[model samples]
Target: MAVSRPTILIPSFNTGPLLLETVEAALATGYPVRVVIDGSTDGSETLLEDLTATDNQLRVHILPQNQGKGAAVLFGLEKSLEDGFTHALAMDADGQHPADSVTAFLELSSRHPEAAIFGRPVFDDSAPALRVNGRKISNFWANLETLGWGIDDSLFGMRLYPIRKLIETLEETRFARRFDFDPEVAVRLAWKGVPIVNLPTPVRYIDPEDGGVSQFRYLRDNTLLTWMHFRLMIGFLIRSPWLGMRGENPLLHLSPPAR
Candidate 1:
């Protein structure tokens, strides 16, 4: 029998120089890394092309137009499945996630291949107070949507997802193709009875002066998330009876790592 291999999927859109840094860090993990360039007009295509030309472990896929983050991720996931990878670790290209923790997360996924491994961020002082506080609302809604399945942070992008299951979940919905990807996927996976594993990892918020770029739109993305939760609530109500009948909650099987 063949063992499961995991790929690191970085979905980037006009991230500029930070893209190279993020890609380098991901490759440092010695895992197969695939970067989906979501029609970035910022010359990232050429940069990535140059890098991939030199690094056999890295592969770059370019989309003709700017698709939302979730769309780019779906593209990568589909490619991963075709390439015989069983899991994909989705990470942001903005240099906020801890690249050093990739090995540990992959190890956890290897042990529990059926569960979604979420990175419960341990943010430093560099993390914006507003951003940190705003995620609480999303987390609250996620727990409610999952009937208290317990998601530590809904907005964090660093997660390890079972490739086949995640692709199936995303195919079932047209939404969650943008900034709402993280939270919506988690809730849906929980609804599908997938196990959840939370691992605490250090996160850094790179200042713009330090070459950080963020694509989150406050007005547009927040509105999308709000509407997403409303739909999830309706789905939750419909699934509650079936959910209650499940004898064991996989969420209760594992405890989040300590800070």
Candidate 2:
């Protein structure tokens, strides 16, 4: 029997110029693809309309107002489940993630159909020094939240999602939206007995001179993440045994490396 091919879903928000690069890279892999426009006023929707018009494999979904990326993803997940697609690989329109890695993630998803595949980024010098360091704090908190659930990096935007389980997760919890979305999703999915597989891929942070615009807010989003983990901790308490007995990571169980 042929391996089941999964669909790829890209959430575009104010992402017009770089949107097609992401789409083209996705199509280059020969997988079914779709884009969800989360209320972008930028003439980008017209681009989406045009793209979908020509490519029978490309479909676009739109929302009226700018709900956050989490909301757009939730919208896409629902539609993916409704459309009968088993898997959806999510990528950002901002060209931060590598296209070649996306094809690899989809292939991994095919092998471990029950697990979510996360892109563990291989960052270049263009990556922000501060953001790079800040991830350690999030990584620490995620490990604590899962009793060391083996989350390599929680903020990577590129990941392959299993639609049915993700939809079930979205319905069960209301915390994943905005910047807190990625970490919350990755951690919680790990808690719910969903295996996570990491694939190393290059991530580029383009200079603003190169038409790059980032929407990350450090203080505000970090506070949101704090609250998200607070909520996840409460759920973790209820699901304590499951997380505790899930597995053992010697790195997590071992003491911090000598400073």
Candidate 3:
């Protein structure tokens, strides 16, 4: 089956030189790429603007101020949908996500157009133990919320989202606008009965000296995730009967495409 090429949607905030490298790598896949600059004050806007001027396949959108990762991603997804794209592959701007796996992920999404393709990170030694272990806690809660619907890694930011379903899922609540994006979206999509496809991809934590910039605030983001999961638990319980019935037919509750 012939599938449309997905737009590469990247949400960036103050990620310095790494954003440039990430964009270049994404463009290498020969797919249309759209980037949302989340009020970056780090001079990345000028750099991206220049690139957009040169490449017709690359488009950049700027937010007036820093909203959050999910907000920026929503902006890009909305714009891509308006432009007639059906799917978007979202990756971070900090260069941790493997660019080499872009083709494989896109291919899988093309084959399984109704499913969300999530990257199951194979972290190298460069990954910090603290962050790695902390994700386990989030993953556990995510599984419980979805009743073991098979989301491999809830916090990994690299994934291919079916634009219509993702936008529909996100519109149900405004809580997924920040660091809670990855996990919240996964659980919500699962609740909507979207099939999950986990693909193994290598992840590397680049050092600062290598132009890697990390915006993860250990205390702040984790606290945000804690609240997010708390709210999801309530939602899960409220939807338990609906969820149980939908289990008999996984495609029973999918939202209609956005108009």
| Best lDDT among the predictions, by candidate number | 1
**How high is the CA lDDT of each candidate model?**
0.88, 0.79, 0.87
The TM-scores, one per candidate, come to: 0.96, 0.91, 0.93
| Candidate 3 CA-lDDT value | 0.87
For candidate 3, write residues 128-202 as lDDT tens digits.
999888899999999888887777789999999999999999899987999999999999999988888788888
Mark the 10 consecutive residues where model 1 has the least summed lDDT.
250-259
Q: What would the per-residue lDDT of candidate 2 be over residues 91-208, giving only the tens digit for each residue?
A: 8888897777767787767777887877777888999999998888888878778886667888888988888878877777776867777898888787777777777778998788
- lDDT rank, highest first? 1, 3, 2
Residues 210-255 of candidate 1: C-alpha lDDT, one tens digit per residue: 8888887889889999999999999999998987775455755575
Greater TM-score among 1 and 3 belongs to 1
Local error of candidate 3 at 48, Å? Answer: 2.1
Better of 1 and 2 by lDDT: 1
Model 3 misplaced regions, further than 4 Å: 1-5, 248-259
lDDT of 2 at 121: 75
- Model 1 reaches what TM-score against the true structure? 0.96
- The local lDDT score (0 to 100) that residue 214 gets in candidate 2 is 77
Against the true structure, whose TM-score is highest? 1
